[model samples]
Target: MNIRLHAGTLLFAVASFLMPTVLHADVFSPTMSYSYADGVALSPDVSYQFNEGIGLSPVVSYQYYEWPGDGVLQLSSSPRVSYLFYSYLGPTPALPTAFSTTSLPPTNMVARPRVPSGTQFLVYTSGAFASGVPLDTNKMTIVLTHGWMSSSDAWPKDMANVLTSQGFGATANIVAWDWRVNANLSAGLEISAARTPSEGEALGGELLYLLGANYNKPIHFMGHSLGTMVNCRAADFIHGDAKNSPGKIPGSTLKLNPQNTHMTMFDEAGAVGVANALSLVTYMLFLPTSGDTGDLINNFWTKVIPDHSAWIDNYISEVGRLHHEAANVLLWRRFAVPVISDISSGLHAYSYDWYSNTVAAPLISAIGHRFSFERNTLSPLPPSGTYFLQSADLIDSPFVVTPLDAATANSLSSGRALVYPTLQAYNGLNVAGNAYLNGLNAAGNVYLDGIQHAGDFLYDVTEWVLSDFNGQSAYVGTGTAGSTPAYMIPAGSAPLQFFWDLPFTLQKSTASPLALNGANGPIIHPADAGPDITNNTAVYVWLPVIVPSNTVGMSFEFKIVGAGTNEYMTMGVSNENYFTMESKFLDDGVWMSSGVIEISKYAGKQTQLFFSMNGDSGLPDGKLSVRGIQFLTVAPPTLNISVNGNQAVLSWPVITTGWQLEQTDALSSSNQWTDVTNAPGVLDYENTVTNVLNSGARFYRLKK
Candidate 1:
């Protein structure tokens, strides 16, 4: 997400926004342009502060240019000024140092800390699916998979560093897969899990060939969105080889138990298979939602209007309704011609033409799509610019029968595309997959590609990341082909271990009632709380989305079940905004209801709930639990320390790492610190330098 500022001079601080401050423009003015696609928009090109992590652009206005008689025409425009969170993690960039609880801005934490040259590799997992760095014999590999429309760059840098850091004596080897050419968005994108099983058998065969006995060692697999599917499919392939042809995988394949693996499902959003593999997974679900492909199409229509003018609106309403009913001949015609015709669309067009030409193409390409049609055709469509144009035109055009209005076009063009809630569902599925593999026990059912395709196999890639690669038991069940197996399917079980408690089942639609009678006091809903729930016990609230610093539509409401007079409970966020519930302690068991509260917003961000108690002990007894906690992304902490005179100073951002410090008296020469004594309170340099000669300029920075 990008934010624009009209003023030329601006100072972005950590407390203000979640994402790193990326100053895209050096000089700001009134007129600016933004390019909106899929779920996000790009601001006008400027001297961006990539290292700084904060983005500064001008607030742009949008309007459609229509022909004199044509009341409505398609147009593209930019978004107004708003604070945005740039990452699925914290808004700020990842820090280069070790983990900490300190709250520092991401922009100021980009200092590249010195890494030991003799760092070994044991903690990280290496990648074999997509192209990556050559594996070293001595280093442990950390394999990472990119999600739909995502790349290696998207992998949290901090995670990579953590994975690579030595725990005991193991050195880490980080491997990033660049599968763009293999899984092009619009092209014949291969579903990691192929239905026939033999379709990806070649890749599978090669994987076993490379792994051989090495498969015994645990290989950490990290993926997002579609990448989760890829990881699961790969595991299935390996599983099939072990079951069907043991010798094909080398060593004792079944002996490699998938349960012994250690997986960490962090910020995943994908399929139900993740939940199914609960027994063998360890998941740290960040933010999750639920959904499918057909739901995706409907969501876009519901949220984004293709046509705004009366004519287009009427036509679209009619056509779209017919299309839904499968009653429109034109809809079928478009589908058949584009999907079935061999003469018109080329091979690449048949597969990928949807990307280059349309505004929607870019959007879809930037994110990701599953079960695309281009891969199945015998004579695939060749690359054609028109196909892209046609696809984009289709997006801009209403399904019914109307031309687009200026506002409608502007909506499409505005680069500030907010992520649809349904997208979170998709993300949730992926997260579930990682959790399932990691033994994190997710909540959801398993669905492949959001489509019920036969033969799409699901594998547990986390097993590879968390298992002991040397000599480990493979199969959980005894061989049943020749004799009775030790383990049998449980009654009424739906793919045990593969599916765990998904959010669909974990979250309750009906909330628990507040205590009408208790010492904690009365509770009420935000609506009944009058102006605030600060004085009562309240819980269970719904927030649509996290807002930017300037967006107007930020609001929150909840119910408070306790009394407002004496002891009370309130809901709110903490310093970092990790959800927290505050309440007053009570001695006697008497409770009063304070009702619910609704808050507009501060700094344009939604107002969180809080409960305050009066007639009670001043201290809280940690009895409150807030369900549905939301957190904005935070930048990583990178501290650069240098000695000036007798004082130590530090500075860092997202990009530029190196820095120079000046001495108190003679600022002439400077020395570099390759190692750092990173302890509590102080950031000490790795090297020791005495103040022999006075220097002119002395600075320390993170090496890029």
Candidate 2:
């Protein structure tokens, strides 16, 4: 076969395998131009011919084109020859010491200042890395692998910068992997699915050659989606009997440690398989995409970490309704194709941007508790566990997910979980031909949506399991076989939650709740002498307040659950507290929201926040749990303003509920603010209210 290399177009970042999207134009079909065959709308020049000579084999002639439609690749009757002949994992373009983290802003802390190199600075960039740079054996090496149709310029480049910023670059060598030809999004998802081994071999072959030249260094391989499988194959090749290189690193000699990759923080993964995965629409929209190679991994690849790396840290999002970011139409069609099922995306959900943001700012929880990943580097293996986390609301939650131990993972088998016949991992000494859970990969059962043939052996080339469950397939009871009843369907369960996020956070005061509650997180006492004293019916105490100098949308916010008529909480700065805000916080704790208190009112001029309550000390309905709490920073709630005709409209997201609109004639430290009487109503996923345009300067906000 002949090949031609052309000057390719630069790429950008997306949640998954992304095709070109007409962001600023209409999506119209070019009628007389072409039509879709199966899922691909092929180029007019792409022609096929069968050889009249010898065996009369079919031949294809084609060149890459900038097509406007979707479906670049397709699933073939037979799998393509898997190799690095075309696909490869290459290095990044020569980077100036500086990187961009505009998409993911890092928190600047005095105690731990962010340098030019840190994981928080990760973002996508275009172009290729310069060649001929020698590997520095003495430095720490990090290899970022991309999934499916994505190029190195996307997540790999972005994440590399993030790692560099977190002090890893001071003594590190970073590289991003590129495998565009194999998994071209325009071609189709199957193309990417079939390319891992070939690219993995390519990466392994390159690393073997580079390391064999006496270039000894500690290497960390990080891949997202299909890239994870690429890493496994690469690791296997490096450790395998390759002609030139026998054992370099990330092989039998090294243990892999990864955080925020495909793995979630949940350790009881095998407990229910993908049956109990997160059903949150927010995560389903992004983290779980076509490139998430998790569904494709057989029993053999799952053991890669145990045999090769140190430890793996899976930080994934769990069950929730509220979306942190709005959904984009760009996710329709091509981007929506799942490798397994609609549930597959939710199973191993995580985003490259989310991973890079871990080392950035921290968030505050309801009742005023702070939560942040708060780490510097990825070296010195992180603790292993599946930790479920939440950070979408105004306030954040203070909970962590844990992973199961390695020793237990290999031997444990649940009736609810589909496992190998040996009751252990496939990579164990027990031999096997095929061991899928009979009906585990069936049409309607396994793949519930998207690519119906994704895991079926009939169409998808890599599908190794038989088509039928157990009833009458020529194959054995792989998915539906065994000593007991057919594990026909999943015993599904609901997602677990231990979080409560309000809208804002600060860095003032420390959490010193009463003795009975606990010593760790911020806690308020039922009968507090701390921030809320029980001396009389009138009680008040101070909390933290900070407005970042650089970013906008800064606000002082919190939520009190039970504050009712019996106990009302009052918020004020230095000399002013509004009657309107007190009323919002007085609805028997059922109705409460102070929205956003204008931060520009008092900047370096020293502004303080004190909460006062009018009522008895021991009222169970009062918000006494957050009495002596301090603060931190997460993204505060947002109130969008737009002009429609002569009217100015105010709106906030549906995720952030109970935020009351308030109008202040002058946003000042001594200004008296009043509530916007016309109650706002939900429309098109936003709480919207129309107000007549004011000729004078008037400020409005939504506080919870």
Candidate number of the best lDDT: 2
lDDT of each: 0.24, 0.32
Task: Compose the digit string of candidate 1's lDDT tens values, residues 1-704.
Answer: 21111111001111211111122223322333532222223335532322122233455322111111111112222243332111111121211111111122222111111111211111233421223223444433344444333445444233354333323114434554434333332211111111112212233344444445355444444443334444433444444422233433565543223421222221122211111111001111211111211111110101111111000000010011111111111111122111111112321012122221221232233111111111111122221110111122334432222222445333333221112111211221111111212111112112111111011111111111011111221112111111111122222211112111101000111233333213322232211121212332222222122232322111121222333323333323211121111121122222211111111133224332222222233322222222212222212325446668765545432111122223233234664344333322211111223333234544443332
Q: For residues 176-270, what per-residue lDDT tens digits would candidate 2 score against the true structure? A: 55665554433233223433444665776666555553444556666655566566566656655322234533344431222212111121121
* Alpha carbon lDDT at 90, candidate 1: 14
**Which 10 residues in a row give candidate 2 its minimum summed lDDT?**
452-461
lDDT of 2 at 303: 21
TM-score of 2: 0.31
